[model samples]
Target: MTTRAGLITSVTLLLFVALVAASALAQTNDSVAAACDAKVKAPDYSLPEWPEKAEVKVFIVAADFNPEQIAAILTPLRNWSAVAEATGSQVTFVYSGPTAEHQDCLNCLTIMRGKVHDNQKHAAELQATVNQGEQTILYARLVIDRVIPNLTALTNAVAHELGHNFGLRDCFECRAGTTVMGLIRSSDGLTGPTRCDVAQVRRVYDHVRIYSAEVKRRKPQQVAKIVPVDEGEEPVDDDTPIVVKKP
Candidate 1:
């Protein structure tokens, strides 16, 4: 998320952020940076890109704690997917509970790397929202004692992190006025992408563009195929809850 770290000392500017925390639902190990700092590598096209007409399927991984609650949260994701699809992008939500076959198990960006150990604590970031181009993938496993009481809280956390999985930079509400890719701070953490984050997924999907599916193995892949921004589609306002349905 775009957080203005402590700005230079100035008499007028008394507020300056020291360190903005990232979102907890993002890639635990992979997401560490915001935008590409080095260079923008041209996407290698081997397989065909996502067809505008075809729908993109995504696999979701949910916690075993509460199946019913998980389903409820997914409904909003489905609706949000429609928003992206209508903008030349499509998404198909896949549940990854009980069976996390392909999805690398959602990871937590907030989790520290050195804090690795076995303690029935599921320390390994086993939950994250994976995205391939326009295809957005989410693995919802965050639960207290296996079940969550506040559905609204669950939706807010997961959906915000999913936004990062789609490659949109996370930022504070202050940045929303300037860039579409603004950082959103939540009770989870800051939102940023690391080397193994968006770029890696983008590479794999981009490869599919040049080469046909003949060589590509049809194992269980995440999401795929996202078209450019369509005209007249305004970005969702920051305050709009991603997972809650309006009454």
Candidate 2:
């Protein structure tokens, strides 16, 4: 009992609504990207980053962290890898097991626990040695305080520190508890990198390099292994590599 013209009009209205929603979403993303760009602060007017398609090996000190603590510490690295995969940025952080095995890794990052000096109030710190001429990172170390309030705090702390390793500086202008690079830890249940954080990473590695063609031909590598730890079960110490790639 419906006219052909009436059915066509209904379909047109539905399509219009869908288009409007898409436009609004795009605008929101643009606004967030702009905010992220403003927060980037480079040292000496230069941004230090790793090479294109580089696989920076990561090793955690087993004596300093237990299974549960290790899981919490690794959450941020996995989050960054996931973001990189989604954005098609060829860089990734691969977990290479204990520090003893990969001591001679060229581009390596080690995370260990250390004392929190009374003079230094920070919960964690990152020390990166960058090659000034090439603007590439050679090696880095992340030292986390021995005593932290909770796992959430530890996760956020690691996320903030890792941001430094990825060529991001602290954003003093960012609103409190909004970005991982901000002065204050986010209070709003965010345990990983934000869209703003990843945007800056993409911006840092946006240059075309001589090895682009070679990188494009390479396959994705295993980033990390995250096994579920059940209640009342012994913590499994499996160092099996797991892959976190874009679908």
Candidate 3:
């Protein structure tokens, strides 16, 4: 008994409701993806020892970043070092802000200030040159934008960028709350690395074993003590007198 116009209106309203429902469902899926607890696979390789004998060095460009921001960045790095402490691996991170002359040097991490891919949306980035077979990080650059001016944002940016140095890769799946390496979500506090991140870093740096130069070189002593031995080739006692056998 409904008129044609009424039927058309009813159909349009139903379509509108369906579209709204679809949009809502998509948002829900996106949120669930972001919150998915997943960890990135750890690197199977290791970085070579630094020529200068440093385990790790983090240098930030002397920009207008404040003390809080710097401290926030250092927190995760120190946590990362703690994982290597079991092997007596000394991981050192210095703020060498602008004073680091060897930013391009091997095994060094340089934090720079610039636009993130010329995109205003991104706050920071991490780039590196890793070697093959050895998987050594010859050099790394951490680009961040101080213009954001948010301390928490900057700190989180630093953590995310440094995560790359520890072998954290971009999320291949819905690996959000599992670690800082995952896709950042509203649920993320952006404070520090999660257990998954620390475990991965440990796996990477645990290969470093501390050894002394003398032990590594296996060099013989310059001087040798003279000892008298038997003519038959048997070793003589310390008190045994040397028997001079002259032909």
Say what the RMSD of model 2 is. 15.7
Query: Which 10 successive residues of model 1 have the least lDDT summed?
Result: 228-237
Give the range where candidate 3 is weakest over 10 consecutive residues by summed lDDT.
Answer: 228-237
Better of 1 and 3 by TM-score: 3
Cα displacement (Å) at residue 114, model 3:
0.9
* Model 3 error, position 215 (Å): 22
The TM-score ranking, best first, is 2, 3, 1
lDDT comparing candidate 1 with the true structure: 0.32
lDDT of 1 by residue, 10-129 (tens): 422433221111222133213223434323322223212233233333443433326655654465456545454323234333433343434333322211112212212211121333
Candidate with top lDDT is 2
Q: What is the lDDT of residue 125 in candidate 2?
A: 58
Span of ten consecutive residues with least summed lDDT in model 2: 228-237
Tell me each candidate's TM-score.
Answer: 0.33, 0.62, 0.53
Clashing pairs in 2: none
Backbone atom clashes (below 3 Å) for every candidate:
34, 0, 0
Cα error, candidate 2, residue 4 (Å): 68
